[model samples]
Target: MKVGVVTFPGSLDDGDARRAVRLAGAEPVALWHADADLRGVDAVVLPGGFSYGDYLRCGAIASFAPVMGEVVAGAQRGLPVLGICNGFQVLCESHLLPGALVRNDHQKFVCTDQRLRVESTATAWTSAFEAGAEITVPLKNGEGGFVADAETLDRLEGEGRVVFRYLGANPNGSLRDIAGIANERGNVVGLMPHPEHAVEAGYGPGTDGLGLFASVLGAGLAAVGA
Candidate 1:
């Protein structure tokens, strides 16, 4: 399977995302924000970064990028897409996913090894993880808080769309300790934590994040019979 990792102007983790895809036994295709085409990749990843310098708001501008036009269309048709950190914000801005990422309640940028509970294993990006499993991954962001209306939050909780929940501390003050969430169809996912950073053993907490990439590749290949 071919996974595309998009690199915006100030994207920081596209390389890591590509590496993670390769480590997961998939070919990593580099994509640019200005390009509308996806280069025939089976899945797409919007890596974390300070795109457009995080000017007006995180991911506000990148949501309108040319490539995201295709991403939005693909996601609606059940394409698998994972958005990390600022990319998560872009997903919300694009309305592909619900909720918004706001400033951390502490009014400071936070970076740490965060513990997350796998709430759902049905999504393409999280199927490799066992439900209710706890895993540690790197979390870094200035505006990582997740917020949504009461009805939307209740619906997400009731429908099992909340994919990951913070285990110990509510690092960013996300509602209901939500660290990540999936779309209704389970094809699209957005999260504040950086899974790509934890795919390797020596670099991060452990290989816990490898499951995310593997899950996407495995699911994509299965869907396409590749």
Candidate 2:
């Protein structure tokens, strides 16, 4: 499987995301923000970082990049797309996923090893995890809070779209402690935590996040076979 990792100006975690993909037994394809192509990769990853210096909004500018056009279209076509941190912001901005990520309730940038519970493992990006499992990964951001209207929250809960939930304590004040969410089709996912940073043993928070990449690769390969 080939997973494309997009790099926008000021993107910090694109290299880490690519390494994680390679460690997951898949080929990592480098994609540029100004490019209109996807390089024929099977899945896509929007890594974390302060894109465009987080001007105006976290992902507001990055969402308008040339590459995002293809990403939005690919996601609509059932191609798996995982967005982490600022990537999550971009996904929300692009409407590939719902809800908005705002400033942390503490009004400060937060960084720590966050504990998260696997709320729904049905999504392509999270299928490798067991429901209700707790895993720790790195979390860092200034505007990582997730918010949505009551109706949208209700729909997400009722539809089982909530993928991960904060455990122990809410790090960013996300509504209902929602750490991650998946689209209705389960093909697109957006999360604030840095799973790619936790894919390796010594370098990452732990090996707990390797499953995310594995899950997507497995799902993509299975879909092709089916």
Candidate 3:
């Protein structure tokens, strides 16, 4: 399998994402923000960073990048896509996922090894994790609070789209302690944590984050089998 890791200006974790893909037994393709081509990759990952200096909003400017157009269309066509940290913000700004991430309730940047409960394994990126399993990964962000209207939140909960929930205390005051979520079709996923940072043994966290990449490799890009 070939997974594309997009590198926008100021993107910090693209290389880590590629390494995670390689560790998961897949080829990692390098993609640039100004380029629209996906290089025939089976899946795509938008890694974390302060894109466009987080101007306008965390991910607002990056959402308009040329590559995102292809990413959005591919996601709609059932291609698996994972967005981490700032990438999550971009996903929401692009409307590929519902809800928005805002400034932390405590009004400060946060970085920690966060515990997350796997809520759903239906998404292509999360199939390797067992339902209700808890795993730890690094989470760092200033505006990581996830918020949505009551109806949307209810729908997400009812439909099992909530993929991961924060364990222990809330990190950034995310609604209902949500740490990650999948799209309605289960192809696209957006989360604030840095799973790529946890893929190696002697790393930020443990190797728990490797499951996400492994899940996509096992299921391919379509979420139907995942």
Clashing residue pairs in candidate 3 are none
Compose the digit string of candidate 3's lDDT tens values, residues 1-226.
Answer: 8999999999999999999999999999999999999999999999999999999999999999999999999999989999999999999999999999999999999999999999999999989989999999999999999999999999999999999999999989999999999999999999999989999898777899999999999888343365
How high a TM-score does candidate 1 get? 0.98
**How much RMSD separates candidate 3 from the native structure?**
1.7
If both were scored by TM-score, which would come out higher, candidate 1 or candidate 3?
A: 1
Give per-residue CA lDDT, model 1, range 3-38, as digits (tens). 999999999999999999999899999999999999
The window of 10 residues in a row where model 1 has the poorest summed lDDT is: 217-226
Residues 1-226 of candidate 2: C-alpha lDDT, one tens digit per residue: 9999999999999999999999999999999999999999999999999999999999999999999999999999999999999999999999998999999999999999999999999999998999999999999998999999999999999999999999988988999999999999999999999999898888857998999999998998898899
TM-score of each: 0.98, 0.98, 0.97
